[model samples]
Target chain A: MNKNFIILGGGQAAVYAAREIRKNDKESNIKILSEENFLPYERPPLSKDFLLNKKNQEDLFFHSSDVLKNENIDFENISINKVDFENKKLFTKNDDFYSYDSLLISTGSENKKLSLDNNLNDDIYYLRNLEEAKTIKEKVSNKNKITIIGGGFIGLEIASSLSQLQKKVTVIEIGSQLMGRIIPKQIADLVQKTHIQYGNEIILNKQINKIIKKNGIYEILLNDNSLIETDFLIAGIGSAPSVKLFEHTNLKLDNGIVTNEFCETSIKDVYAAGDVSNFYHPLYERTIRLESYQHAQNHGICAGKNIAGVKTEYTSIPWMWSDQFNLNLQLTGICDDYDEIIERGNDINNGVIYFFLKNKNIRGACGLGIAGKVGRDIRITSKLTEKNIIVDKQILADQNQKLNKLIQK
Target chain B: MSEENWIEVGSTDSIEEEDLIRFDHQDKTFCVYRLTDGFYATDGICTHEAVHLEDGLVMDDEIECPMHQGIFNIKSGEALSPPACEDLKTYPVKVDNDKIFIKID
Candidate 1:
C-alpha cells in the first residue's frame, strides 16, 4: 500500500513541499489543507507588484489549480481545528478528520495586532497575506494622509510604493532608524534618506499611544504628547506563527513549533516548516524561525523530501530580498552575531555592499541598490571558509575586480 | 575598410593577472579583466542598476556587483542572482603584438 502524506497550511512551504514530495514519490497520496481559499501564490509581491496593481493574482500563484488537479493532489480550503499526534489524525473546523501516514504543518504566520483602545475605526489596516493587500490597495485610493505604525521592511516598502502613487505617507518607527533590526545604523540611515528623498516622512522613536477616529478622519496620539491627523492607518508591526491548531497536540513549542534540522517535530511522523516551525540552524548554531519566502520554501523542500523517505537536511544559506522604491536590497547568511562590518563601494554615489565579519571571517552580507547589476555565475560558499582569503575593502570597491579572484587564494 | 575595427586600447602589461580595467571604445564602455586562465570582457555597467561592474570584485569565474553583491558569470554573462534577471553582453577580445583588440561587432 502507498503511504499517504497530509500537509496542513497552503502557503509557499506547503506548496513547495508538496511539489518536491510528488517529484520523489510519484505514487504517494498527497493531500493539502489550506485555510485560505486560493492556490499557492508568491506572497513577496503582495507589497511590491501586486499591491501596486502591476501584477494580478494569477501572476503571484506558484502552482495553478490545473497542476494540482493534474497531480491528483487533494486540496481542501478548510481550516484545521485540532491535531492528534498519537493517532496521526487531524480534525478540521468543518468536522473533517484526516488520517495521515505522515503530516507536515506549514501554516505560515499571521500579522501581529496592535495594542490600542477601541476608539480607532475601520480605516486601520494590517497587511499579512493577499486579502489584506487587496483591501489596502482598494482603501488607499481615497486615503490622503497614511500613517504607517511600523518602520520595518514591509512598512518602509509600502511607504515607498504609496508615496510613488502620490499618497502622503508617514512611517512611525519606535526605533531610532528604519530597518534597524536587519541592517546596520548607517545603512538604515541611507534607506531613510532614500525614503526622505522621495518626499516621505519618517517619525522615529515615536510610539503610537492611541488612535481616535472622528468625522471620517483618524487622530493618532503619540507617546511624545503629539497628535497627527490621518485619513488612514497601516500597521506593519510584525508576524507570529499560526500555531493555534496545534494547541492540543504534543508538539514542542518554543518561539514557534520546535523542530530539528530535518524539520521533524517532537512527535513522531510529524513535521513543521515555514513560519510555524522554529528550526535549528547549523550555521547560527541555534533554533531560529524566519518569516521570509526563502526559509518557507526551503523548509517545505526539506519536509517534502523527508516525508518521501529521502533523508535530507535543511542547510541552505539564509537569504532575503526587499524592493522599496528603486532600491533593491539583498542579504545573505546571518549578521546578528557579527563583531565588525566591512563596507564596500561608494555609499552615496554608486551603491553599498556590507560584509559582516566575525573574527576575520565573512559571516553575512547586505547589498543595497546593486542586485540587478551584479553577475550571477558565482558560487557563494559559507563565509566560514573565506576567512583565510585576503580581501581589501579598496580592491572590492574597484568595479574591475572579479569576485572569483577573491576566492581563488 | 570596415571602419578599422582593430584599435589598440591597452597593452598586455597594462593589466596584471586577476585585474579589471575599464575602457571606452566607440563611445561604448567595456570592462576588461584578466583571469588566471584567460582575459574576459563584459559590459561596464551592471545590469541591475547604475553601479559599475568594473568596480566589483571578481571571485571564481564571476564578478560580484559592487553595488548589490549580485553575482554574474564572467564567461557566460548570466546573472547568477536575483534583482538582476538580465545577462550582460560579452565581447570578443584578442591580443596581438602586446595590444588588446576587442571586436565591436
Candidate 2:
C-alpha cells in the first residue's frame, strides 16, 4: 500500500526530504505544504548575493516548478494553523485538513523581532523569506544610512552586503562582542575590525534606550545616551524554532520539536528535521537544534531515508559558513566544553584556524580567511573531527603541515 | 597554436598523488588532478559556484568543492551532490616525458 507523506514546510529541509522520499519510495504520495508562495529556495544567499543583486530571484530556487510537478511532489502554498496528531491530519488556515500516513515537520525558524515603544516605522525590516528580502532590496535602493539591529550572522551579512553597495551601515550588537555566543572573542574581533575598516560602524554592548520616529527617519537612542538617525533599520538578532503549530500537542518540545537519531518524534509516524527539531546527535551525545544549510539538507535526507524504511541515523557533523566582505568564515562541529584551544595559521593574508580540542580529540574548528583560503582546511578539520582522530597540537598549528594528511593516518 | 592545441600545464611531479592543481591558459582555467593511475583535467571553477577548485579537497578520485562541499568525480567530472547539478566540462589530458598537457579548443 502506498503511504501519503506530507511535508509541513517549503524550505530546504522540506524539499530535500520529499526528494529523498521519492528516491526510496516511488509510489508514495508526496505533498509539500509551504506558507510562502515561491517554490522552496535557498535562504543563505538572501542576505548576501541576492541582496547585492548578484543573484536574481530565479537563481535562489532549488528547483523549477516543472521539476517538482514532474517528480510528483505536490507543492501547495498554504499555512497550517493546527494539527490533529492522533489522526495524522493537518488543518490549514482555511480549515482544510489533509490526512497523512507520515508527516515531517520542517517548519524552520523565524527572526526575533525588535520591539520599542511607539515604533511605527514601515521601513523597519526583518528578513526570513523571499518577500522580505525583495522588500529590503527595493526599499534600500534609494536609501543611504541604514542601521541594523543585532550583530548575529544575518545582521552582519546584511551589513556586509549594504557596505559593499556603498550604503552607510551601522551594526548594533547588545552583547559585549559580536556573535559572542558561539564565536570566540579573537575571531569576532577580527570580523569587527574588518567591518570597521570598511567604514561600517559596529556598536557593541549597547541596548536600545528609545526609538523616536519623525517624518520618515528613525532616531535610535542607545543606552549610553548616543543617538543614531538612520534612513532605514534592519533587525537580525536571532531566531527561535517555529513550533507554534504544535504548542498544544503531545509531541515533546523544548527549544524545538524533540526527535531521536532516526528523526522519529514522540508520535509513531511523525518526524521532525531542520531548524525546528531538537534532535539527539549520536556524535555529540546531546540534543541540539541547528539552523543552517548543511543541517537542513542532511537532516531532511536522514528523515526521508528513515520514513522510506531505510532506518538511517542522522550523524552528519555540524558545518556552517558566513561570508562577510571578502572574508569567508567556516565552523565545523561544536565549539564548547573543550579543555584546550589550538591556533593555526595566524596570518589574515593566508588564513587563521582555531581548533577546539578535548583530551587530544578535535571537538570543533573555526577558521577565517580571504574567500577560499579557509574552506579546504575547515573541510579537512570537519572530516578529522568526524573520524574521532587524536591530533597533535604542534602539527595542527603548523601552517606548512597539511591537515589532510591526518585523515589518512 | 599547435595542431592539436595541447597546452603543457606543468610537470606531473608538481601535484601529489590523489591531489589536484589549478592551471590557467590565457583566459581559460582548469584543474589538473593526479591520481594513483594517471592525470585528469576539468574546469577550475566549481559548477555550483564561482570558486576555484584548486582550493577543494581531493579524496581518491573525487574532489569536493571548497565552498559548498559539492563532490565531483575527477576522472568523469560528474557532480555527485546537491547544490551542484551541472557536470563539470572535462578536458582530455596526456602526459609526455613527465610533463602534463591538456587539449584546449
Candidate 3:
C-alpha cells in the first residue's frame, strides 16, 4: 500500500509542498486541507492588484484543478479541529477522520485582531484572504473616508491601493515612523513622503483606543482622545501564526510551533511549515519565525521534500517584497541586528537601496524604488556580511563600479 | 578571420570605441557595443520589461534597464537586479576589418 501524506492548511506553502512531494514520489497519496474554499492563490496581490480591482480572483491562483488532477493530489476544503498524534489521524470540524503516514502543518496565518469592541460590523475589514479583499473592494466607494490601522507593509500597500481608487484614506500607526520594524528611519521617511504626495493622510504615534459604531458610521478614538470618523476601518496591524489546532498535542510551542532544522515537531511523524513552524536558523543562531511569502514557500518546499523520505535541511536567506504606491521594496537577509547602514543612490525623486552592514559586511539590504536595479549588486550585498568581505561604501554607491568586480575580490 | 558569415552592419566610422548601438536582424533586436577590448552583441530588450536596453545608460560592462532600471551584464546576459527575474540571451559577434556581423543562432 502507498503511504498517505496529509497536509493541513492550503496556502502557497502547502500547494508548493504538495507539488514538490508529488514530483519525487508520484504514487504517494497526498491530501491538502484548507479552511478557505478557494484554491491556493497568491496572497501578495491582495493589497495591490486584487484590492485595486485591476485583477480578478482567477488571476491570483497559483494552480488550477487540472494541475492538481494531473499530479494526483486531493484537496479538501474543511477546517481541522485537531490532530490525533498517537493515532496518526486528523479530526476535521465536519466529524471526518483521515489517517496518514506523514502530516504537514502549513496553516499559514490570520490577521491579528484589535482589542477594541466587537462593534466591527460590515463596515470594518481585515484584508487577508480573497474573500475579505473582495468584500472590502465591493464596499468601498468613491470619496469614502477609510481609516487603516497599522503602518506596516500591508497597511501602506492597502492605503496606496485605496487612494488610487479615489478613496479618502487615513493611516493610523502607533509607531512614530512608518514601516518602523522592517526599514530604517531614512527609508521609512521616503515612503511616508510618497504616501503624503499621493494625498493620503498618515497619523503616526497614535493608537486606536476604541472603535465605536454609531448610525452606520465607525468612529475610532485614539489614545490621545482624538476621534476620526470613516466609512470603513481596516486593521492590517499584523498576523499571529495559526497554531491553536495543535494546543492539545504534545508539540512544543515557543512564539510559534517549535520545529527542528528538519521541520520535525516534537511529536513523531508530525511536521510544520510556513508561518506555523518556528524553525532554527543557522545564521541568526536562533529559531526565527518569518511571515513573508518567500519564507513560507521555502519552508513548505523543505518540509515536503523531507517528508517524502529525502533528508534535507531548510536554510535559505530570508527575503520579502512590498509594492506600495509605485515603490517596489525588496529586502534580503535579516536586518534586525545590523550595526550600520550603507546608503546607495540619491534619495530624491527616485529611491535608494540601503545595505545593513556589520563588521564591514552586508547583513541585510532594503531597496526602495530602483534599489534592485543593480541585480549583481543586490546578490553580492546579501553575502557580503556572511563572507566577511571588505567593501568600500563609495564603490557600492557609484553606479560606474562593477558589482561583479567587487564581489570577485 | 572569415568574411563569409560576417555581414556588413554599418560603417566602422559610425560607431566609436566604447559606444553602444542597436540593430535589427531577422525581426529580433540586437545591441552592439564597442568595448575597449572588442565588440559584443546582446538582446536589446530589458529582461524586466519590454524596455529597450539601448535607451539605457551603459556603465563599465553592464547596461541598466530603461523601464525599471534593472542592470544586466553585457557579456553573460545575466540580470543583476530584481524586478527582472530572467536573463537576456547573448549572441556571438564577429567583425571583419570594418563590417560587423551578429550570429542569429
TM-score of chain A of 1: 0.94
Candidate with top DockQ is: 2
DockQ of all predictions against the true structure, Cα-based: 0.16, 0.72, 0.12
- What overall lDDT, based on C-alpha atoms, would model 3 receive against the true structure? 0.79
* Docking quality category of candidate 2 according to DockQ thresholds: medium
lDDT tens readout by residue for model 3, A1-409: 8999999999988988898899889898999999999989878878888887777898777778999999999998998797888899988777789999999989987888876666464455899999998888877754489989899999999999999988899999999999898777877898899899999999999988888888868888889999899888888888888888877778898878888888998888888899887889776678988888778777988988989988888767777777777666767787777788777877533447788877766778877664334333555565565565778888877756655555442
Chain A TM-scores, candidates in order: 0.94, 0.98, 0.94
Report the C-alpha lDDT of model 1 over A117-223, residue by residue, as the tens digit: 75453556988888989999999998889999999989988998899889999999999888888776766887888899999999999998878888888888899
- Overall lDDT per candidate, in order of appearance: 0.78, 0.90, 0.79
DockQ of structure 1: 0.16
On lDDT, the leading prediction is 2
Model 2: lDDT equals 0.90
Q: In candidate 3, which residue pairs get closer than 3 Å at backbone N, Cα or C atoms, i.e. clash?
A: A362-A385, A375-B80, A375-B81, A376-B80
The TM-score of candidate 1 is 0.81
* Model 1 misplaced stretches (Cα beyond 4 Å): A119-121, A370-400, B1-105
Clashing pairs in 2: none
